[model samples]
Target: MDALTAEEADPVADEHGAHQRGGGPGRRPSDAQAVVPPGALSPAERDRSWSRLGDEDFDVVVIGGGVTGAGVALDAATRGLRVALVEARDLASGTSSRSSKLFHGGLRYLEQLEFGLVREALRERELMLTRLAPHLVKPVSFLYPLSHRVWERPYTAAGLLLYDTMGGARSVPGQKHLTRAGALRLFPALRRDALIGGIRYYDAQSDDARHTMTLARTAAQYGAVVRTSTQVTGFVREADRVAGVHVRDVESGAETSVTANVVINCAGVWTDELQRLSGSRGRFRVEASKGVHIVVPRDRIVAESGLILRTEKSVLFVIPWRNHWIIGTTDTEWNLDLAHPAATRADIDYILEHVNSVLATPLTHDDIEGVYAGLRPLLAGESEDTSKLSREHAVARPAPGLIAIAGGKYTTYRVMAADAVDAAAADLPNRIPASITDKVPLLGADGYHALVNQADQLAARHGLHPYRVRHLLDRYGSLVHQVLAEAADDPELLKPVPGSPDYLQVEIVYAASHEGALHLEDVLTRRTRISIEYPHRGVESAEAAARLMGRVLGWDDETAREEVRVYVARVEAERDSQTEPDDQTADARRAAAPEARPRLEATA
Candidate 1:
C-alpha cells in the first residue's frame, strides 16, 4: 500500500465516525481523542497521502520518528503550532525501539557527577509515571550485586539513598540492603559466587516502541499531520535557511514538498547525515554505539526481581519483561547497516559469558529465545572508548530555521524535544507558547489508574483471562477497550495468534490500522513484540500473521507470501550470523539477506 493515495481516503474520518465526540472506548475526558484506529489506513488511504501534503504548509516539520522526533511533534502540536512529522519508515523504527527500555535517571550518572542530567531525567520519569503516560510507564526494581562485603554495601547504599531522594523515586519503594542469603532468597537463579550481597533499587520501564507510536498518535490527535513511510529526500532551502523539506512516499515512490517555517532534526544517529543534507555545519559528531541484548524465557531464570551485574565493559541487566527475561547489552562501535544491526557471535558470547557467571544453571546459546541490537547515538568524545562517551544530548541551531537535537537517552527525550522546539521557536515570527507537555497526559494516560482497578471486570467483559486483560491494560491502558472492540467485530480476532501465544490476532490488525505500521517487519518487530518474545522470531507464525495483516493492508496472495518470506529470511540470517565470531563476518552474513524496502534512514 502506498502512503500518498492512502491519505486521500481520510480513513481516520471514515473508520471513526466523523461526529465522534470524546476519546474512544476506555479513554477519559482529559485524554486526547482517538483520531485514527488500528484499521483506519486502508490501501487506498495510504496511496493518497502525498497529494495531501502539498495542500497545506506546516509551521514546523520534524525529520525523524524516533522518541525524540515523536516527542517534538507532540510538543509542537500541543502548543498550537501547525506541525508535520515525516519518517522514512515506520515510527520508532530505529534506536528508539531497540532501547534498554528503562525510563531511568541513570543511577550510574550519579557516579559520573552528572547531577543536572540525573535530576532532569528524574523529573521526566516522575511526570511520565504520575501525569503523562501512567498506563505505559511503570516501576521496576533492580538488585545491584555487591561483589565486596565491606565498602561495597556502604558505597552502594549511599548511591541508593541519593536515588531514593530523587523526585521520581517517591512513587516506588526505597532501596533495601540484603545479605548474600537474603539476596539468594529473592533470586535463587544467582550463583553463590556471583555476589557477596546486594542492594535493591527502583527504576521504571516501558515498551519503547509502543510509547513512541503513542506519542506520534497523540500528536496526530492534536492536529499534527503525522505520516510514516515518508522519507525526506532533501532539504528545501530558501536563501541561506532551511525552509522545508522534499519528502518521498517510500512505499509509492512519489515525492511532495512540505513547507515549514522551522525544521527540527531529531534523527538520533542520523543526526550528522541530516545536518549535511541541510548544509549546516555542526559542532559535534554522533557515533553509533552498538548494544546487543538476548531474551530468554522467564522460567529459565528464577528471580523475584531483576538483576544488574557489573561487566568488564559496562553494566549487564537481567530485566523482567512480561513472561520473558531480557539480558543484554555489549558496548562496541558499529559501522554496519543502521536499519538492521546484527549481533555477532562474539557479542552473544560476551553477554552469555557475563550473564552465565551469575546463573546457577548456565544458559547456552540454545537457551536464547531472541537476539536484538540497537545503536546508541553517542556524542563523540576524544576517547576512542565508546563507553566513556557522554550519554547527555546536545541541541544545536546550525542554520537559520534549522534546529537539531542529538545524543540523549530515552528517559530524557521530553527535555530534548522541548529544547529543540525552543530553539526552533526563535526563528518564527509569532510568539510560541511555553511547553505544557508536562501537564498534558498522553492519549491513554488520563484514566489508566481507574481502569487498572477494574481489570477483572474488563477481562470478564472481554471473555479474556484476568491476567491477559491486565497485560493488555498495562501496554495499552484505557485503549485496551479499542483493541477489544476490534475483536468484538470478529470472533476470530480474539483467538491468540499461532506460534506467538502471548499476543492476540487483533493486536496485529491494530498495528496496521492505528499504529502506522507499514510493513510486516513493523508489525512483528515493533508494534507487537513477537520478534523479540518468541524463540523463532515469529518465523513459524509469519504466514498466518501476514494473512491477517493482508486482509487490512490489501496485500495480494503473492505480496503476503513475499512478506512472510522476507521476515523469515531476516530471522534466519540473524540466527545464522549469531554463530559467526565477530561483527565484520556477522554483519557480512546478515547483509547477504535482502534489505528492507522503504527503509527509514536517520539523519540530523
Candidate 2:
C-alpha cells in the first residue's frame, strides 16, 4: 500500500511494543501538552465563538456538527491545528441522532465475508467501551435466535468465534451459546417456535445524539471553536483551490467570512448537496436510505436482553431503552426531505408486522410512545439495493483544498474523521500530528466509573435520589457536580418536567446554558429526547421547559410563549405526518411546522 488508509494504518512496532493506531508505521511521537479551557458552551461562549468566526482564520474549518464532523474537529485540534466546527442546526440533528444506537461489529456483514469491516468496527467498539467513552458507550447483549437445529449452531458459533477473537473484543464478555430453555429465559418475549436455541453475544449501545454532543464539547475543551446554528453558505474560492467559507449565523442572520487552509465536508446525507454547491463532481454518489424506528413500552417485549431478528432485507433490532423497547428499522429507499425524514404509516406498520411475528402478545399502534425516522448515507454501488451498498467510507480531494467524507457507520466515525484530516494534510501549514484521540478520552469519560461508585453519596449531598444521581453521572460524567450546582439555589430545578418525568428541569436549563440549545426544539428533541420518549411528544412539557430555558437564554414572556407554541405545533405536525402514506405527503405535513429560529429559514 502506497499510503495506508486510517483503518489500515499500522501501529508503531516500538521497543515498548505499544500497538497505537493511526500513526505512520513504526512511529510513536509525543504531543505537546496544551492548556485547554473549560468545555462549557454557555450563551456567552456561543456569542464569543460567533464573533471569533468573523475575525479569525483557522487551519481547518469542519462543516457539519454531527459525530463525524465533531470527530474531525477534535482530531485536527488535538494536532495543534486551529479548528472551527460549524453546524447549520443542532449537533446530531440529522442521521447521527436517529440510529439503532448500537456500537458493534455488524453481524450481518460476516455473511458477506466483510471480515475486515467487522474487525475494524469491533476494535472501535472495544476502544469506546474501555478507553474512549466508558460513560457513553456501554456493553449491551443481544440474542441471535436459531431457526435450524443441527448446522445452525456450528455455523453461527464459527462466525461468533471469529467475532470474538478477530478484533480482540475483550472489554465486553464473549459470545455464549445457550439452550432453547436458556434462551427463552433470557428473552421470554421470544416465541418458542421462533427458534430452537440462541447465541448470546455482547455489543454496546449509546444515546447517539448525546454521544455526538459530547464529542463537540470534548473538541471545544481541546481548543476547537465549536459553533452550532451556523451555516456555511458558499466556498471562499481563490483562483483554483478553496480558501475559506462564507457563513451565516442561523440564529442572528449575521454573515461573515471565515478563512481556513482546508475545508472538510462531513455533511452526512447532505454530502451531494454540498458538493453541488462547490461545483465539484464528487468521486461517488450518496443515496439516502430511510430507516424508521418505533418506540413502545418496555413491557411490550418482556426481554432482559435485546433481540436481533433476521429480516429478508436487513436485520430488525428490538433494543432495550430505559422504560421502552425501541423496535425498528426498515431500510428502504427514500428520496424525500433531508431535514425532517418522516415515518409514514406504512413504515410503522411494516416494523410492527415483522416484530409481532415472534411476540406472544403483539404490540399495537397504541403501544407506541414515539416515532422517529433517519436517513443513512449509503454509497451508491453497482447494485440498486441500498442495503447492498457498501458501508465502507471514502475520502476524496475532488478539488485542491476540499476533502469530503461519506458512507460510514456511527461506530467508526473517529477513523473516518482521521482519514479526512489526513486528506487535508497537504494544505495545512505544519506537519499535523497523528490521531491521539484513541489515547484522549471524551470530557465525561475519565472519572465516570468513580462518579458511578459515589452515586449514593452524591444523591444524599444533593438531596436527590440515588437513581437520579446515577443518571446524571452517566449523562455528564464528572461534570455532574457542575450540572447539579445549578439547582442549588432554586430547588424547583430539581423538579421533573410535566409530561416527561424522565428528565429534570435543571437538564432543560443546562441544555441552554451549556449544551448550545438555541431553541425549544433543540431542548426537547436532541438534548433530552422528550419528543420521542413521551406520549404527547413533548407537547405538555414544552411550555414548562421553554420557560426554564427562557431564563438562561434571556427570553421574555412573549418569546417563551412563542417557543412553546412553535414546539406544540411541531409535535402536532409530526404526529399528523406519521399518518401519511408516502414521502411526498409526509414531507409536506412535516414542513408545516415553523422553524424554532425563524432567521435560519429566512436566511436560507
Candidate 3:
C-alpha cells in the first residue's frame, strides 16, 4: 500500500471539504523525523516535564491525552510551535484504548449515505497502512455474511463495490464474492444455514492503545512536552480571554499553572466538563454512548477470516486478535460514570446471543476471558436514537484562547486535530505554519521495513527467539533496540513474565521507565495488554507487574503491595460488574474499585 497525498488520493474527500483545513501544510513523503531518544517517561522525566510546564510559556497546551489530543500536540509541534500535552491519567486510558481496534472506513455509514465521512476515513486508513505507521496498522480480511436472497446479495455487492473504490480502497484487494460453500470453507465455525453467501473484503486493524502511546512519544520527539498523571483543574483567565490552565499533579496533588497562547480541548467524553470549567458555553452537546466488547480464545472460533454480522440495532464484528477473537460493541445511552464504563451481564449476553446465532458451537460465559466497555462521545442531534448520531466532528472557538473539538470516530483523529489547531490560530500571534504531521512518520516508522527484513539477524544478536524478536519489532519498530538495551545488564529481563508468558518481563520495566506508566494498571491495561489477553485479566500478573513497576518508579514494598491490591480489586470489580443485570448496577460495582491516581479538587 503506497500512501498518497490528499490531492492525489481521494478527490471526493477534497471536494466535500468536510473537515476544516489547517492553513496548508508544506509536506512531502521525503520528510525525515528528527533523531532524538524522546525523553523517556521515567521518574526523572516526569519531574523534567513538570518543571518545564511550570517554567515554559508554550504556544499551545492540549488537555487530554487521547488520540485526538496527542494528534493535536503532534500537529502543533511538527509545525514548529511549542506544545504541552497533559493527561489526567495514562495516555489512551479512555475511549482511544477501548475501541474495536479497527482503522476502517465505516461500512455501515454507506447505508446512511455518509460518503464524505467514509471517504475521509478510508484515506486516513491508507496513510496509516502505507506511510505513517505501517508497523502499527495491519490489514485484515472480513466475511460479510449475507442472509437474504438475490436483493441482499446485489445490494451488499453494490455497497462493497463503492467501498472498494472510494477513498483509495485500491490500496488493498477489492471485495471478493463468495458462495455459501466457499464462505463456510473460510469460516468453518459458522453454521451452514447461517448465510446464503458472503462478501470477503479487506480492512485494517491495529492496537489502539499502542498507536496512541506512540503518537504522543512521536510528538515528544518533535519537542512536545508530554506529561501523564497531570490534570487540568481549571482555566487561567486574563480578563475575558483564556490565558492558561491551572493544573494539578495527580501523583503529588501539587498545584501549578501552564501559560499558553491557546488551549485546545480534546477531552473525548469529558469535553463538556472541560468546557464548563472554562466558563464558556460549549458550541454543542456531547452524548456519551456506551459500547461493550468481550474477548474469547481463538480456538473457540475456527476461522481463516473475521466475520461481520448485521444485528437488528447495528453491526457486530468478530475481529481476530492474536490467540483470541474480540467480539462485541453494544451501543446505548450512558449517563452514570464517564471514567469507567462498565459492561453488564446483559451486554455480554447480547453479544453472545448475536454472535452465537451464526457459530456452529455456541460460546458460553465460561468461554469469555475478558470484557471491557468504552464510551463514544456522540454529538447530540434531533434523533433520540444514539445510533443515528453523526460521527462527523465539529470544531469551535467558544471563547478567546479556547478551542473545543469533539464528535468523530477513531479513524479521523488526525483530520480533527488539524481542524482544531486551525481553529485556535486566531489566538496565535503571527501566521503559523500548516499541519506538517501528514508528512511526519511516527517515532518508529522511519526504519520499520528495514528492521523487519533484519529480524532474524537482530534476534540472533539479542539472544532471543525469532518469534519474540518479531513481536517486539512490530510493537516498538526501531525502538525495540531501546527496550532490549535494558536487558544488557540483567539478561533475565528477557524472560517471559511469570503469569503472562506471551510478553517478556523487560516490557513491564520499559513501560514504566520509558512509556510513562504511573501505576501497575498502566502496564497491565494499556502498555503491555496483559489485562485483556489472559483469562484472569492480569489478576495473576498484577503483583509480578507491580514488582517490575516498583523497581522503576521507586515504589517501596508496601506501595507495590498496595498497587497489586488495587489492580486485583479492579479485576474483581470488572468481573463482578459483568454479572450485573444492567448499566446502573454494573457502573456501581465498577466504580467501587479505587482509582489508581486520586483526583484533586480544582482551584483555578
Assess candidate 1 and give its lDDT. Answer: 0.79
TM-score of each: 0.91, 0.92, 0.92
**What is the Å distance of residue 461 in model 1 from its true position?**
2.0
User: In model 2, which runs have C-alpha deviations exceeding 4 angstroms?
Assistant: 1-37, 381-391, 601-604
Per-residue alpha-carbon lDDT of model 1 for 341-360, expressed as tens digits? 88988999999999998899
Model 3 off-target regions past 4 Å? Answer: 1-36, 381-391, 600-604
lDDT of 3 by residue, 1-604 (tens): 2222222221222111222111112211221121114534555657767888999999999999999999999999888889999999889999999999999998999999999989899999998988899889999999999989969989998998988888876668888999999999999999999999999998999999999999998787677889988899889999999999989998898889999999999998999899899999877789999999999999999999999999999999999998899998899999988888999999999999999999999999999988989999988633333212234887878889999888898889999888889888999997999887778887667778987888888888878898998899789877777788657667888999988998998899878767888899999999988899999899898888888777667788899999998898899899999999998999899989998886643221
Which candidate should be chosen as best, given lDDT against the real structure?
3
Model 2: which ten-residue window has the lowest total lDDT? 27-36
**lDDT tens per residue, model 2, 326-381:** 88899988887788888899999999999999887888899999999999998864
For candidate 2, list the clashing residue pairs, or say none.
none
lDDT of 2 at 569: 90
User: lDDT at 306 for candidate 2?
Assistant: 92
Better by lDDT, candidate 3 or 1? 3
